[model samples]
Target: MKKGVFLLCLALYAFSVTLTIFVQAAGIADEKLRLLSSFGSLISFFAVLAMLFLIFRLKDNKESKVKSCGQKQRKNPDEKNPSKEKYLEFAARNGLSRRESEIGYLVLGGLSNIQLAETLFISLATVKKHLTHIYEKTETSGRKEFAEKVKAF
Candidate 1:
């Protein structure tokens, strides 16, 4: 009976040790998985950065090649619009919003307030409001003076 009891105790101890070893191994594997996941994220971040760098480098290279080949860079339409610079200057001096500046430029084109409202998809009252502001800023009495000033600019 003593021998049987001793053997049973030994079997229980061995089973407990085996379980502890497996638990420790699982913990090590978990740590390794976390490390691998962090590395993957870091690699992907650098890959994206590298791709952006390459894209910008290629764009600059193309621009330089164009310059070397004597191809004139296309001018923006805004640059060609003679009144655009004057409107920009007016906006800067008057602290006008972009929409107001656009409306002012259109007013200089001989369009009435009602026509402006219809063309810009706004109500007549809104157009009149913008015009009032524009007139005050430019110190103009009416459309004739505004057009004359813009043309002089």
Candidate 2:
């Protein structure tokens, strides 16, 4: 949508420039008016280009952040300290119900309580209850700490 608007603006600018040139050739537009029109056109074009460059840079930064987040998720670990899978396995090994495991995974995935409730077809109250039990069992403060602890697993 933004790109479309930009293109439309560029096209309108081109049309305006063409019209200005035609008017000047026909002796209708004065020299001062023509010079002002050219200056305005240059400023508008540079401004648009700068804006587009900034947008591209922002998009690239967002992509890099997403890639780094994925890399963190896929990091390999030695057999010594507990890994994320191990922590999850421990949760399962401790006889946590499958629903609780699902909740744990969602929490680890950075979903908020409301997001988890919507995704799991559960109520917000139920999500809170499950999260409380999860915190107690995992011995973590909240979701952010829970995710950090899981990262060590």
Candidate 3:
């Protein structure tokens, strides 16, 4: 994360420097207006690049998390939860308690165990226990893959 921010800052700095150089070189008759345009363009370019980078990073994280959860689930098949047609069905099939089911849902939604616990008003230890049960039932080894399976259900 720090690296990403650093890179973005570096990119912005380089862009600004380049824009200054270009404006100086163009030496248009309207020096003030040309400098302004160059500055504006640089700002716009950097903004677009930053937005794109953020979106890409978010998407990549989500996909990777999903993959990790799925791989975990595949590693253990003995803990097959019940097969409900709906998302609720997943909870029922898995024999997860009401709270466990809720936690599981959150986990499936890409929340970390700590995040889920906080959201659900539970202790981290309790959250881990619930996750253990969830993993056992869902046969997921990681949060990402578990989330994928839950989403599919």
Candidate 4:
């Protein structure tokens, strides 16, 4: 719908420009020619504004979708999955903090540092900090070792 509106505005602007040019070349009266030129300029200005508005709207929508999807993926790990429940229990057993446990669960699920950061709405440094804490608490060196240990549950 937005694209269609943008296209229609562009067409109207083009038609207005053509009309202004035709009026100019046809030797119309000065008053009428000025009026047509002003009308054309107004049409062009509005068309540009509409196009910009649509462009920004589209960009905002895409960004919103990404944030919402990230939020959805960040849902509580213990909600429905048996494996996640076990993982959370394991995290608790190992004395991991809540934030550390969350990061650990994502790591176990094979999320990269960047994915973890985006999904949890934290900085990459924060995610790394959580991972470090998780590793220390679980007696693991890194993601691979942690995954191996968690799977052993």
Per-residue CA lDDT of candidate 3, range 27-74, in tens?
Answer: 766868686767857775776677677778877866765555443333
Query: After TM-score superposition, what is the CA distance of residue 95 in candidate 1 from its true location, in Å?
Result: 2.5
Off by over 4 Å in 4: 1-82
lDDT of 2 by residue, 1-153 (tens): 656666665776676667666766777657777776677677667756755775787678657654543332322333133455786686876456778877787565556676666566578999999888888877888877776766565
lDDT of 4 at 41: 79
Candidate 3 residues lying further than 4 Å off, grouped into runs, are 1-85
Query: What would you estimate as the lDDT of candidate 2?
Result: 0.67
Better of 2 and 3 by TM-score: 2
TM-score top scorer: 4
TM-score of model 1 (CA atoms): 0.43
Task: Name the TM-score of candidate 2.
Answer: 0.42
Point out the higher-scoring one by TM-score: 2 or 4: 4
Task: For each candidate in turn, give its C-alpha RMSD to the true structure in angstroms.
Answer: 21.9, 9.9, 9.9, 9.6
Q: What is the lDDT, from 0 to 100, of the residue 105 in candidate 4? A: 74
TM-score winner between 1 and 2, please give it.
1
Worst 10 residues of 1 by lDDT: 71-80
- What are the lDDT scores of the predictions, listed in order? 0.64, 0.67, 0.68, 0.78
Please give the RMSD of candidate 2 to the true structure. Answer: 9.9
TM-score of 3: 0.41
RMSD of 4: 9.6
